[model samples]
Target: MANKTAPDSPPGSAGGTPTRRRSERSRRAILDASLALVGEVGYDKLTIEGIASRAGVGKQTIYRWWPSKAAVLLDAFTADVDEYSAQGLPDTGDLAADLKLVLRATADEFNDPAFQAPYRALAVAGANDAELSRAFVDRLLEPGIRVYVDRLRAAQEAGEVAADVDTRVAAEMLLSPFSQRWLMRTGELTYDYVDTLVDLVLRGLRPGS
Candidate 1:
Protein backbone atom coordinates (compact mmCIF):
# COMPACT_ATOMS: atom_id res chain seq x y z
CA MET A 1 0.00 0.00 0.00
CA ALA A 2 1.26 3.50 -0.87
CA ASN A 3 1.31 6.30 1.71
CA LYS A 4 -1.02 8.66 -0.10
CA THR A 5 -1.42 11.37 2.49
CA ALA A 6 -0.27 14.81 1.32
CA PRO A 7 0.05 18.21 3.01
CA ASP A 8 -1.64 20.99 1.05
CA SER A 9 -0.54 24.66 1.05
CA PRO A 10 -3.92 26.22 0.47
CA PRO A 11 -5.81 26.41 -2.86
CA GLY A 12 -3.14 28.22 -4.82
CA SER A 13 0.02 26.84 -3.33
CA ALA A 14 2.74 25.06 -5.33
CA GLY A 15 2.90 21.29 -4.89
CA GLY A 16 5.55 18.84 -3.73
CA THR A 17 8.37 17.48 -5.87
CA PRO A 18 6.76 14.12 -6.63
CA THR A 19 8.83 11.71 -8.80
CA ARG A 20 7.66 10.91 -12.32
CA ARG A 21 5.80 7.71 -11.40
CA ARG A 22 4.42 9.33 -8.26
CA SER A 23 3.44 12.40 -10.24
CA GLU A 24 1.48 10.26 -12.70
CA ARG A 25 -0.30 8.56 -9.84
CA SER A 26 -1.13 11.90 -8.27
CA ARG A 27 -2.47 13.26 -11.53
CA ARG A 28 -4.71 10.25 -11.96
CA ALA A 29 -5.87 10.50 -8.39
CA ILE A 30 -6.64 14.20 -8.64
CA LEU A 31 -8.56 13.76 -11.85
CA ASP A 32 -10.56 10.90 -10.46
CA ALA A 33 -11.18 12.82 -7.23
CA SER A 34 -12.39 15.97 -8.90
CA LEU A 35 -14.80 14.14 -11.21
CA ALA A 36 -16.15 11.87 -8.47
CA LEU A 37 -16.58 14.71 -5.99
CA VAL A 38 -18.33 16.97 -8.48
CA GLY A 39 -20.77 14.21 -9.33
CA GLU A 40 -21.57 13.49 -5.70
CA VAL A 41 -21.57 17.10 -4.44
CA GLY A 42 -22.62 19.04 -7.57
CA TYR A 43 -19.68 21.45 -7.40
CA ASP A 44 -21.27 23.81 -4.86
CA LYS A 45 -19.76 22.02 -1.90
CA LEU A 46 -16.83 20.45 -3.76
CA THR A 47 -13.73 21.35 -1.77
CA ILE A 48 -10.09 20.80 -2.67
CA GLU A 49 -9.49 18.84 0.48
CA GLY A 50 -12.46 16.63 -0.30
CA ILE A 51 -10.98 15.73 -3.67
CA ALA A 52 -7.62 15.06 -2.04
CA SER A 53 -9.14 12.66 0.45
CA ARG A 54 -11.18 10.78 -2.13
CA ALA A 55 -8.22 10.54 -4.49
CA GLY A 56 -5.88 9.48 -1.73
CA VAL A 57 -3.60 12.34 -2.74
CA GLY A 58 -2.60 15.73 -1.41
CA LYS A 59 -4.55 18.84 -2.20
CA GLN A 60 -1.31 20.46 -3.28
CA THR A 61 -0.91 17.79 -5.94
CA ILE A 62 -4.16 18.97 -7.53
CA TYR A 63 -3.12 22.61 -7.45
CA ARG A 64 0.10 21.79 -9.25
CA TRP A 65 -1.87 20.45 -12.25
CA TRP A 66 -4.87 22.78 -12.24
CA PRO A 67 -5.62 26.28 -11.08
CA SER A 68 -9.19 25.31 -10.21
CA LYS A 69 -11.45 22.34 -9.62
CA ALA A 70 -13.10 22.57 -13.05
CA ALA A 71 -9.69 22.58 -14.67
CA VAL A 72 -8.93 19.28 -13.00
CA LEU A 73 -12.08 17.71 -14.45
CA LEU A 74 -11.53 19.28 -17.83
CA ASP A 75 -8.20 17.48 -18.05
CA ALA A 76 -9.72 14.22 -16.95
CA PHE A 77 -12.35 14.34 -19.65
CA THR A 78 -9.79 14.89 -22.38
CA ALA A 79 -6.96 12.79 -20.96
CA ASP A 80 -7.62 9.84 -23.26
CA VAL A 81 -8.34 11.06 -26.78
CA ASP A 82 -8.67 7.50 -28.02
CA GLU A 83 -11.88 7.07 -26.06
CA TYR A 84 -13.58 9.61 -28.27
CA SER A 85 -12.73 7.65 -31.37
CA ALA A 86 -13.66 4.36 -29.78
CA GLN A 87 -16.89 5.45 -28.15
CA GLY A 88 -18.07 8.10 -30.55
CA LEU A 89 -20.32 7.34 -33.52
CA PRO A 90 -18.97 5.35 -36.41
CA ASP A 91 -19.72 6.77 -39.84
CA THR A 92 -21.40 4.28 -42.14
CA GLY A 93 -21.77 6.51 -45.27
CA ASP A 94 -25.56 6.77 -45.11
CA LEU A 95 -26.20 10.23 -43.72
CA ALA A 96 -29.51 9.48 -42.06
CA ALA A 97 -28.34 6.25 -40.56
CA ASP A 98 -25.11 7.82 -39.37
CA LEU A 99 -26.97 10.62 -37.64
CA LYS A 100 -29.26 8.15 -35.96
CA LEU A 101 -26.31 6.07 -34.89
CA VAL A 102 -24.56 9.06 -33.38
CA LEU A 103 -27.66 10.27 -31.63
CA ARG A 104 -28.22 6.80 -30.20
CA ALA A 105 -24.67 6.81 -28.91
CA THR A 106 -25.31 10.19 -27.34
CA ALA A 107 -28.40 8.86 -25.65
CA ASP A 108 -26.49 5.88 -24.31
CA GLU A 109 -23.84 8.16 -22.87
CA PHE A 110 -26.27 10.72 -21.46
CA ASN A 111 -28.62 8.27 -19.79
CA ASP A 112 -25.90 6.34 -18.00
CA PRO A 113 -26.01 7.00 -14.26
CA ALA A 114 -22.25 6.86 -14.03
CA PHE A 115 -21.76 9.27 -16.91
CA GLN A 116 -24.82 11.42 -16.27
CA ALA A 117 -24.23 12.15 -12.62
CA PRO A 118 -20.85 13.69 -13.30
CA TYR A 119 -21.93 15.32 -16.55
CA ARG A 120 -24.98 16.96 -15.08
CA ALA A 121 -23.06 18.16 -12.04
CA LEU A 122 -20.31 19.64 -14.17
CA ALA A 123 -22.74 21.19 -16.62
CA VAL A 124 -24.64 22.83 -13.81
CA ALA A 125 -21.46 24.11 -12.24
CA GLY A 126 -20.26 25.42 -15.59
CA ALA A 127 -23.42 27.47 -15.90
CA ASN A 128 -22.36 29.44 -12.85
CA ASP A 129 -18.62 29.54 -13.52
CA ALA A 130 -17.51 31.16 -16.76
CA GLU A 131 -14.08 29.63 -16.59
CA LEU A 132 -15.52 26.18 -15.98
CA SER A 133 -18.08 26.62 -18.74
CA ARG A 134 -15.46 27.56 -21.27
CA ALA A 135 -13.24 24.75 -20.14
CA PHE A 136 -16.10 22.31 -20.45
CA VAL A 137 -17.02 23.47 -23.92
CA ASP A 138 -13.45 23.47 -25.13
CA ARG A 139 -12.33 20.23 -23.57
CA LEU A 140 -15.32 17.92 -23.40
CA LEU A 141 -18.04 19.30 -25.66
CA GLU A 142 -16.53 21.09 -28.65
CA PRO A 143 -14.31 18.24 -29.72
CA GLY A 144 -17.31 15.94 -29.94
CA ILE A 145 -19.32 18.61 -31.77
CA ARG A 146 -16.55 19.04 -34.30
CA VAL A 147 -16.66 15.36 -35.09
CA TYR A 148 -20.25 15.77 -36.22
CA VAL A 149 -19.34 18.84 -38.22
CA ASP A 150 -16.66 16.92 -40.05
CA ARG A 151 -18.94 14.00 -40.77
CA LEU A 152 -21.63 16.30 -42.13
CA ARG A 153 -19.13 18.07 -44.34
CA ALA A 154 -18.12 14.75 -45.77
CA ALA A 155 -21.74 13.89 -46.44
CA GLN A 156 -22.14 17.13 -48.36
CA GLU A 157 -19.12 16.38 -50.53
CA ALA A 158 -20.39 12.89 -51.23
CA GLY A 159 -23.82 14.18 -52.25
CA GLU A 160 -25.58 12.39 -49.42
CA VAL A 161 -26.72 15.65 -47.91
CA ALA A 162 -28.53 18.44 -49.70
CA ALA A 163 -26.06 20.52 -51.65
CA ASP A 164 -27.21 23.80 -50.11
CA VAL A 165 -27.64 22.57 -46.55
CA ASP A 166 -25.60 24.41 -43.96
CA THR A 167 -23.46 21.60 -42.64
CA ARG A 168 -22.68 23.41 -39.40
CA VAL A 169 -26.28 24.24 -38.59
CA ALA A 170 -27.44 20.88 -39.86
CA ALA A 171 -24.97 19.20 -37.59
CA GLU A 172 -26.31 21.21 -34.69
CA MET A 173 -29.88 20.31 -35.50
CA LEU A 174 -29.00 16.65 -35.39
CA LEU A 175 -27.21 16.71 -32.03
CA SER A 176 -29.01 19.52 -30.22
CA PRO A 177 -32.31 17.69 -29.94
CA PHE A 178 -30.71 14.95 -27.91
CA SER A 179 -28.75 17.46 -25.89
CA GLN A 180 -31.94 19.31 -25.06
CA ARG A 181 -33.48 16.11 -23.79
CA TRP A 182 -30.51 15.24 -21.62
CA LEU A 183 -29.95 18.71 -20.19
CA MET A 184 -33.52 19.33 -19.18
CA ARG A 185 -34.49 15.78 -18.24
CA THR A 186 -37.53 16.48 -20.36
CA GLY A 187 -37.77 12.89 -21.59
CA GLU A 188 -36.02 9.57 -21.72
CA LEU A 189 -33.35 9.22 -24.37
CA THR A 190 -34.13 6.34 -26.67
CA TYR A 191 -33.09 4.72 -29.92
CA ASP A 192 -36.55 5.13 -31.40
CA TYR A 193 -36.58 8.80 -30.42
CA VAL A 194 -33.21 9.38 -32.03
CA ASP A 195 -34.27 7.57 -35.17
CA THR A 196 -37.42 9.64 -35.40
CA LEU A 197 -35.47 12.85 -34.99
CA VAL A 198 -33.09 11.82 -37.73
CA ASP A 199 -35.92 11.04 -40.09
CA LEU A 200 -37.77 14.25 -39.37
CA VAL A 201 -34.71 16.42 -39.83
CA LEU A 202 -33.65 14.73 -43.02
CA ARG A 203 -37.06 14.46 -44.71
CA GLY A 204 -39.04 17.26 -43.04
CA LEU A 205 -41.92 16.86 -40.59
CA ARG A 206 -44.79 18.11 -42.82
CA PRO A 207 -47.40 15.50 -43.61
CA GLY A 208 -47.36 15.90 -47.42
CA SER A 209 -44.85 18.58 -48.19
Candidate 2:
Protein backbone atom coordinates (compact mmCIF):
# COMPACT_ATOMS: atom_id res chain seq x y z
CA MET A 1 0.00 0.00 0.00
CA ALA A 2 1.22 3.46 -0.87
CA ASN A 3 1.53 6.02 1.87
CA LYS A 4 -0.50 9.21 1.64
CA THR A 5 1.44 12.46 1.33
CA ALA A 6 0.71 15.41 3.60
CA PRO A 7 -1.05 18.41 2.02
CA ASP A 8 1.89 20.70 2.90
CA SER A 9 4.66 18.17 2.36
CA PRO A 10 6.05 19.92 -0.72
CA PRO A 11 4.98 21.47 -4.02
CA GLY A 12 4.61 18.20 -5.89
CA SER A 13 3.88 15.98 -2.94
CA ALA A 14 0.28 15.40 -3.99
CA GLY A 15 0.98 15.76 -7.71
CA GLY A 16 -2.00 18.05 -8.45
CA THR A 17 -3.82 20.80 -6.52
CA PRO A 18 -1.20 21.30 -3.85
CA THR A 19 1.51 21.55 -6.49
CA ARG A 20 -0.34 24.26 -8.41
CA ARG A 21 -1.03 26.26 -5.27
CA ARG A 22 2.58 26.02 -4.22
CA SER A 23 3.70 27.15 -7.65
CA GLU A 24 1.46 30.22 -7.45
CA ARG A 25 2.69 31.08 -3.96
CA SER A 26 6.28 30.80 -5.09
CA ARG A 27 5.64 32.94 -8.15
CA ARG A 28 4.00 35.69 -6.09
CA ALA A 29 6.84 35.52 -3.57
CA ILE A 30 9.44 35.85 -6.30
CA LEU A 31 7.73 38.87 -7.83
CA ASP A 32 7.14 40.61 -4.51
CA ALA A 33 10.73 40.01 -3.43
CA SER A 34 12.07 41.27 -6.75
CA LEU A 35 10.00 44.47 -6.52
CA ALA A 36 11.07 45.08 -2.92
CA LEU A 37 14.73 44.54 -3.73
CA VAL A 38 14.55 46.89 -6.72
CA GLY A 39 13.14 49.56 -4.44
CA GLU A 40 15.88 48.96 -1.86
CA VAL A 41 19.01 48.63 -4.01
CA GLY A 42 17.95 49.77 -7.49
CA TYR A 43 17.75 47.45 -10.50
CA ASP A 44 21.42 47.66 -11.46
CA LYS A 45 22.35 46.18 -8.11
CA LEU A 46 19.54 43.62 -7.95
CA THR A 47 20.36 39.92 -8.26
CA ILE A 48 18.56 36.61 -8.42
CA GLU A 49 20.27 35.56 -5.21
CA GLY A 50 18.95 38.55 -3.36
CA ILE A 51 15.45 37.90 -4.61
CA ALA A 52 15.70 34.24 -3.69
CA SER A 53 16.79 35.14 -0.19
CA ARG A 54 14.01 37.67 0.23
CA ALA A 55 11.43 35.33 -1.17
CA GLY A 56 12.50 32.37 0.96
CA VAL A 57 12.79 30.18 -2.13
CA GLY A 58 15.58 28.30 -3.79
CA LYS A 59 17.36 30.00 -6.67
CA GLN A 60 16.28 27.09 -8.83
CA THR A 61 12.67 27.96 -8.19
CA ILE A 62 13.12 31.43 -9.67
CA TYR A 63 15.22 30.19 -12.56
CA ARG A 64 12.63 27.60 -13.41
CA TRP A 65 9.90 30.22 -13.74
CA TRP A 66 11.86 33.20 -15.14
CA PRO A 67 14.84 33.00 -17.46
CA SER A 68 16.45 36.18 -16.10
CA LYS A 69 16.23 38.92 -13.52
CA ALA A 70 14.75 41.28 -16.11
CA ALA A 71 11.99 38.77 -16.78
CA VAL A 72 11.20 38.62 -13.09
CA LEU A 73 11.15 42.39 -12.81
CA LEU A 74 8.86 42.64 -15.81
CA ASP A 75 6.44 40.19 -14.22
CA ALA A 76 6.53 42.11 -10.96
CA PHE A 77 5.90 45.38 -12.76
CA THR A 78 2.75 44.00 -14.36
CA ALA A 79 0.71 44.08 -11.15
CA ASP A 80 1.12 47.82 -10.64
CA VAL A 81 0.71 48.44 -14.36
CA ASP A 82 -2.57 46.58 -14.35
CA GLU A 83 -3.73 48.57 -11.36
CA TYR A 84 -3.23 51.92 -13.11
CA SER A 85 -4.67 50.66 -16.38
CA ALA A 86 -7.76 49.34 -14.62
CA GLN A 87 -8.27 52.73 -12.98
CA GLY A 88 -8.24 54.27 -16.48
CA LEU A 89 -8.57 57.98 -17.18
CA PRO A 90 -10.76 60.14 -15.02
CA ASP A 91 -14.20 60.97 -16.41
CA THR A 92 -15.64 64.01 -14.73
CA GLY A 93 -17.45 65.19 -17.86
CA ASP A 94 -14.69 67.78 -18.39
CA LEU A 95 -12.10 66.77 -20.96
CA ALA A 96 -9.48 69.34 -20.04
CA ALA A 97 -9.82 68.78 -16.32
CA ASP A 98 -9.83 65.02 -16.68
CA LEU A 99 -6.81 65.11 -18.96
CA LYS A 100 -5.01 67.42 -16.57
CA LEU A 101 -5.74 65.05 -13.71
CA VAL A 102 -4.45 62.04 -15.65
CA LEU A 103 -1.32 63.83 -16.78
CA ARG A 104 -0.60 65.03 -13.26
CA ALA A 105 -0.79 61.49 -12.00
CA THR A 106 1.48 60.36 -14.83
CA ALA A 107 4.01 63.04 -13.93
CA ASP A 108 3.91 61.96 -10.33
CA GLU A 109 4.58 58.36 -11.33
CA PHE A 110 7.52 59.35 -13.52
CA ASN A 111 8.97 61.52 -10.76
CA ASP A 112 8.92 58.67 -8.26
CA PRO A 113 12.33 57.05 -8.01
CA ALA A 114 10.83 53.88 -6.63
CA PHE A 115 8.64 53.43 -9.67
CA GLN A 116 11.31 54.69 -12.05
CA ALA A 117 13.98 52.22 -10.99
CA PRO A 118 12.22 49.07 -12.15
CA TYR A 119 10.77 50.94 -15.12
CA ARG A 120 14.16 52.03 -16.38
CA ALA A 121 15.53 48.54 -15.98
CA LEU A 122 12.56 47.04 -17.77
CA ALA A 123 12.83 49.60 -20.54
CA VAL A 124 16.44 48.73 -21.12
CA ALA A 125 15.66 45.05 -21.14
CA GLY A 126 12.79 45.51 -23.55
CA ALA A 127 14.92 47.59 -25.86
CA ASN A 128 17.58 44.95 -26.06
CA ASP A 129 15.22 42.02 -26.58
CA ALA A 130 12.58 41.92 -29.31
CA GLU A 131 10.36 39.30 -27.68
CA LEU A 132 10.45 41.09 -24.35
CA SER A 133 9.68 44.42 -25.99
CA ARG A 134 6.60 42.98 -27.67
CA ALA A 135 5.50 41.46 -24.36
CA PHE A 136 5.99 44.77 -22.58
CA VAL A 137 3.89 46.60 -25.12
CA ASP A 138 1.16 44.00 -25.11
CA ARG A 139 0.99 43.68 -21.35
CA LEU A 140 1.65 47.23 -20.18
CA LEU A 141 1.99 50.01 -22.71
CA GLU A 142 -0.89 49.13 -25.01
CA PRO A 143 -3.32 48.56 -22.16
CA GLY A 144 -2.55 51.98 -20.71
CA ILE A 145 -2.86 53.60 -24.13
CA ARG A 146 -6.18 51.84 -24.70
CA VAL A 147 -7.50 53.50 -21.57
CA TYR A 148 -6.64 56.89 -23.00
CA VAL A 149 -8.34 55.98 -26.26
CA ASP A 150 -11.46 54.95 -24.39
CA ARG A 151 -11.48 58.23 -22.50
CA LEU A 152 -11.19 60.20 -25.71
CA ARG A 153 -14.06 58.26 -27.24
CA ALA A 154 -16.17 59.06 -24.21
CA ALA A 155 -15.32 62.74 -24.59
CA GLN A 156 -16.29 62.59 -28.25
CA GLU A 157 -19.66 61.14 -27.32
CA ALA A 158 -20.17 63.98 -24.86
CA GLY A 159 -19.39 66.60 -27.52
CA GLU A 160 -16.23 67.61 -25.65
CA VAL A 161 -14.10 66.42 -28.58
CA ALA A 162 -14.55 67.10 -32.27
CA ALA A 163 -16.22 64.48 -34.44
CA ASP A 164 -13.42 64.33 -36.94
CA VAL A 165 -10.51 64.18 -34.51
CA ASP A 166 -8.63 60.88 -34.64
CA THR A 167 -8.85 59.62 -31.07
CA ARG A 168 -5.92 57.23 -31.54
CA VAL A 169 -3.64 59.94 -32.82
CA ALA A 170 -5.07 62.38 -30.34
CA ALA A 171 -4.37 59.98 -27.49
CA GLU A 172 -0.79 59.54 -28.68
CA MET A 173 -0.34 63.31 -28.70
CA LEU A 174 -1.53 63.42 -25.14
CA LEU A 175 0.87 60.72 -23.87
CA SER A 176 3.88 60.57 -26.18
CA PRO A 177 5.44 63.89 -25.18
CA PHE A 178 5.80 62.89 -21.56
CA SER A 179 7.13 59.45 -22.57
CA GLN A 180 9.69 61.00 -24.90
CA ARG A 181 10.71 63.55 -22.31
CA TRP A 182 11.23 60.89 -19.70
CA LEU A 183 12.97 58.35 -21.94
CA MET A 184 15.28 60.84 -23.67
CA ARG A 185 15.77 63.21 -20.74
CA THR A 186 14.87 65.92 -23.19
CA GLY A 187 13.19 68.12 -20.56
CA GLU A 188 12.01 68.29 -17.03
CA LEU A 189 8.67 66.55 -16.57
CA THR A 190 6.45 68.54 -14.31
CA TYR A 191 2.77 68.92 -13.65
CA ASP A 192 3.06 72.27 -15.34
CA TYR A 193 4.51 70.73 -18.47
CA VAL A 194 1.80 68.09 -18.55
CA ASP A 195 -0.82 70.75 -17.97
CA THR A 196 0.54 72.68 -20.93
CA LEU A 197 0.40 69.58 -23.12
CA VAL A 198 -3.16 68.89 -22.03
CA ASP A 199 -4.15 72.48 -22.78
CA LEU A 200 -2.67 72.36 -26.24
CA VAL A 201 -4.29 69.01 -27.05
CA LEU A 202 -7.65 70.11 -25.74
CA ARG A 203 -7.51 73.32 -27.68
CA GLY A 204 -6.78 71.48 -30.86
CA LEU A 205 -9.09 68.56 -30.34
CA ARG A 206 -12.02 70.26 -28.70
CA PRO A 207 -15.07 71.13 -30.79
CA GLY A 208 -15.18 74.60 -32.42
CA SER A 209 -12.25 75.83 -30.35
Count of clashing residue pairs in every prediction: 0, 0
Report RMSD (Å) for each prediction in the order shown: 6.2, 5.4
Once model 1 is optimally superposed onto the true structure by TM-score, how far is the C-alpha of residue 161 displaced, in angstroms? Answer: 1.0
Stretches of model 2 off by over 4 angstroms after superposition: 1-28, 36-47, 60-68
> Per-prediction TM-score, please?
0.79, 0.79
Candidate 1: segments with Cα more than 4 A from true spot: 1-22, 80-89, 204-209
Report, for every candidate in turn, its global Cα lDDT versus the true structure.
0.72, 0.81
**Which one wins on lDDT?**
2
Taking the tens digit of each residue's C-alpha lDDT, what string does model 1 give over 141-171? Answer: 7777878778777776876766777767866
Clashing pairs in 1: none
Model 2, residue 46: C-alpha shift (Å) = 4.9
